[model samples]
Target: MTLFFLPIPVNSPLPDLTLADILERTIELSQTAAVILKSYYRGSPAQLEVIDKAEGPVTVADKAVDRHLLDGIQAMCGDSCGYLTEETYQAGDFQLPQDWVWIIDPLDGTRDFIDKTGEYAIHIALTYQHRPVLAVVAIPESDRLYAAIAGGGTWNITADGVRTPIRVTGGKELTKLVVVASRNHRSEGLVKLLAQLPCQQQLKIGSIGCKIAAILEDRADLYVSLSGTSAPKDWDLAAPELMLIEAGGKFTRQDGSLLKYNQGDVNQWGCLIASSGEWHQQILDACLD
Candidate 1:
C-alpha cells in the first residue's frame, strides 16, 4: 500500500495538499483498503468469520480494513483531524468533533459482501466545519469508484485508472423515476413509503454509497430512507452526500434539512432523501404530505 492519503507533519491544517492532490491520493488509498477486503473475500458466504453486533453482522474484513485506514492516517496525520469511523466510534465516548473530521464506513454493505452480492462499497469523507468537502466511494466488486471535491464536481473512476466526470439525471417525471434502494435493510414501513412513490421502478442495491452512486451516475434518480427501525450514521451519509451534491444532486431530510456531521450524536435518523437536484422537492412533497 502506498499510503498516499497523508504523509505530512502532525497538527497541520487538513494537509496542505490541494483538493486535487487529496482526491487522487484518497482514490489510491481506497483501492488499498479494497485489497484488504479482496484478500479475505472468498466466493462462499461462509468463507469469513463474523460476529453479531448491536449494529449488524460485522466481519473480520471490516475490522482489518478499519485498522488499515485508521493506522495509516493516524501514523501520518496525528491530531490533524478527528475520526468518526463505523467500527470504532461507538466503542468510545462521543463528543463534539474537531473542525476537521474524517467520517468513514470501512465496509458499508457487510451483508451484501457476505452474500457475494457485489453491491457493497467503501466510503471516505473529509469534512471541514461539519460539511463534507471531499468524498470517495469505492465499489471494488463492480470496479467502479465515485469521487468528488467541493466545487470540483464528481467523477467515476474505473479499475484501470480511467476517470470520467459524472452528474445526476436532473429531475424527471414522477412516474418515470427510478428508485435506488436497499437490498437487505428493507422494512415494511419503508415498503409502504416506496409503494406511494409512483416511481417507474425500485432497484434493490446495497450500501448508501452505492445507492448515491447510482443517482450520481444516472443509473437511478432517487433514494429515500425512513430509518426503517434503524438509522444510518454520519459515516454512511457524509461521503455519499458530497458525491451526489457535486454531481448536481441533493441529499437531506424529507423536511428539507441538510445533514451535519461530527456532531455529538452519531445517528442521522428520519426521512433521509437523496435525489437528482431539480426535482428533489417533489419527492419531499410527495412523501411527507
Candidate 2:
C-alpha cells in the first residue's frame, strides 16, 4: 500500500479543515492502521517479539502502526498540530507548540494481540484546547469502526460501511448495572471499588477502546479503573472517552472530574469511571465512598 506522510514546507500555510472533515480523515487513517495491525497479527505468534515496557508489553506491530498513524496524521494536519502516540511518546513530548494535538494508540491491547485474541484496536483522537473534539476507534477483527465528533452523535460503522447511531442504555439501577473491567491490568483498588457497587455482572475485556465501545453499544453499563501505579495514559483514554461521552454517557475521574488531554504529563493517576449518564453520579459516589 499507500503510506500517507508527506512533509510540508515550514512556510506553507495550514489547511482550513473543519471538525467534520477531520473526523472523516481520522476514520480513514484508523482503517489504514487497522489493516497494518491485522497483517502483523495474522503472522506466526512465535515471530512476534514482545518487549516489556514500563507499563506493559510492546510489539513490532505497535511501533509500525504507530509510525503509520503518526506520519499519516502529521501529513494530513501538517506540522502546525501536535502529535503524541504510545510508541513515540516521551515524558515531555506533550510540550508542543500547537493548541490542537492528535493522540493515538496504534495497536491497543498488545498482550491480547500477542495472544491472538483479536481484541485489539486502533485509537485516534483530535484534542482541541486539551479536550477531545473528534475520535475514532477501529477494530480489525470485527471490521467495525466507531467514531464521534463533539456535539455530534456517536456512530458505529460496519465493514460494508453501514453506519448506525449508538447510545448508552439509560437509568439502570446500581444492582442491575453491567460492569466492564480491564482484562490485563485489574488492580486491588479496582476490585474493592467494584465490591461497593452491586452490579449484575462484570465483563473483563482487553483494550480501552473495546470497553468503551461496550458502553456505546449498550452491552455494558459501566467501566471503572482505579489504578494506583499503572494508570492509563492519554492515548489509551482520549479517543474512547470522547466516543463514550458523545454516545450520551459520562466519563470522568472517579471523583467526577472531567479528564483533560494534551497536558505535559500523560499519566491519568486518579480513578476513572465510564457510565451511562443516568447513573454516573450514583456510581461515582458509591465507588469513591
Candidate 3:
C-alpha cells in the first residue's frame, strides 16, 4: 500500500503555508478519511450502532471519523485554528480564534450511509477571512476525490491518483436544465420552487457532496435547498460551496448573498441555490414570491 502523508512546511507555521500547499494537504487528509469511511462501510451492518441526535441519526462511524479528522487537522494546523464539524460541533464553536478554521462533515450523508446507499461523502474545508480557501470532498464508495482552491480551479482525483480538471457546463436554456435535490431531506418549499423551474429533468440524491458533484461533472445543472425551521449547517455547505465556485459554478443564498463562514450561528437559515453561473440569476428570480 502506498502511504500518503502531508508534508508540513519545514520550520514554518501553518499560517505561512500557501493556499496551494493547504489544498495539497487537505487532499491528503481527505484520502485518509476515505480509507476510514470505506472500512466502516464494508463492515457488518451491526457495527453501525445507530444513535439518534436532535438533528438526525448518527452512527459510530460518524463520531469515529469526526474525531480522527478533528485530531488530524489540529495536529497538522495546531489547536489555535478554529474547528467546526457536524459530529462534535456546538452552536458557539465557531466563535473561537479564527485566523483559519476547518469546517468539516466527517460523513456528509449519515442517513444515506445507514440506508446502505453509497452516495455519502467526507468534506473538509479551510476557511480564511470568512471565505473558503481550500476544500476536499471524498466519495469513498466511488473511490473518487474532488478538490479545489479559491482561485486555482477544481479537479477530480481517482483512487489510482489520476487527476482530471473539471468544470460546470456553460449556460443552458432553463427548459433544458437538469436539477438535483436532497434525497432524504426534501422540503415542501423546495418542491414548490422546483415546480416553478423550467428544468426538464430532476434527480434526488443523498449527499450535498454528491449533488454538487453532479453539477461539477455536468451530470446536473443545479442543486437547490429551501430551508424551513432547521437549515443546513456550516459543515454541510463549506466544502461543497468552494468546490462549486471553483468549478466555474455559483452557490449562494436565495437572496443572492454569498455564504460567510465561522459565524457564531452555524445554521444557514435560508434558501440556497447552486447552479452553473449561467442561470443563477434566473433561478433566483423564479424563486421570488
Candidate 4:
C-alpha cells in the first residue's frame, strides 16, 4: 500500500484542483484508515469490544477510523470547506461556508468490518453546489481503490499506481438483472418485494457504498434499498452515488426523487436504487406499486 500521507499543497491555485487531486487525497485518508482497520481485524476480545449507540452497533475501529479521515479532510481542505459525516455531525450541524462541502462515511460497512468479512470500505466525496464532483471508495482489506471525478470518469487505482476505467453493464431485461441487496440492513418487506422482482440473481453485500460499487464495476446490475423509517443517509450514498453516476450509472429514491444532502435529517427516508439505467425504471415502478 502506498503511504497514507497526503501530498497536496494547500497553496496551489484554485480552479486547478483536478479530480485526480481530490481522489489522491481521498485515497490517502482511506489508506491511512486501512492501516488502523487492519490492526483490529479478527480482533481479540478487547479489540472486539462494541458500544451500542442509539443508531446501531459501533466498534472501536469505526471511531478510530473516522477520526483518521476527519483529521485527513481537515488537513487536505483546511477550514475552507464544510463537512458532514456519519460519525461526527448531528442534524443541526449542517451550516456551512459556500465554497465546497464534503460528505463522508469514514467506514461504510461497519457490520462487515466487525464480522471480519473484508467487505467494508472508506467513502469520501467532495460536493460542489450540492452535486458530487469527486468520490473515492477504498476497500482496505483488498487494498483496492475505486474513485471518480464527475464527467472525468471512474477508475480502479491499483497498489502500483495503475488506473483503469470502470463501466457498468447494460443488461436488457429485468429477469436478467442481478440485484445486490444489503447484508445487515434489510427488512422483511424488502425481501418480499425483491422476491417478486424479475431478478435472475440476488447478491447480499455490506454497505450501501459497496452495493453501489458492485453496480459501478458491473459485478451486479442493480442495488435496491426500500425502507421508510430506517432509510439511508446522504453520507452513506453520496460518495457511491457520485462514482456510479460518473461510471455511466443512475441512482435515486424509489419514487424517482433525487438524493439531496445536509437536510438536517441524516436518515434519508425512502426507497433507494442504483442501477445501469436499463432495468432501473422497472425496479422503481415495481417498488412504487
Best by lDDT: 3
Q: Candidate 1 regions off by >4 Å?
A: 1-12, 43-47, 91-93
Determine which window of 10 residues in candidate 3 has minimal summed lDDT. 1-10
Provide TM-scores for the models.
Answer: 0.90, 0.92, 0.92, 0.88
Better of 2 and 4 by lDDT: 2
RMSD per model, one decimal: 4.0, 5.2, 3.9, 4.3
Error of 2 at 263 (Å): 1.4
What digit string (tens of lDDT, one per residue) describes model 2 on residues 182-219? 78887787778888886759888898899888777778
Backbone clashes in model 4, listed as residue pairs: none
Ranking by TM-score: 3, 2, 1, 4
lDDT of 1 by residue, 17-97 (tens): 565666677787898998888877753556567888777889989998889888876655579778889988765336645
Report how far residue 101 has shifted in candidate 1, in Å: 0.6
Better of 1 and 3 by lDDT: 3
Question: What ranking emerges by lDDT with the best candidate at the front?
Answer: 3, 2, 1, 4
lDDT of 3 by residue, 22-130 (tens): 6677788888888988888999888999998778899999988899888877877886578888877754644656667888999999999988889999999888767
Clashes of each: 0, 0, 0, 0
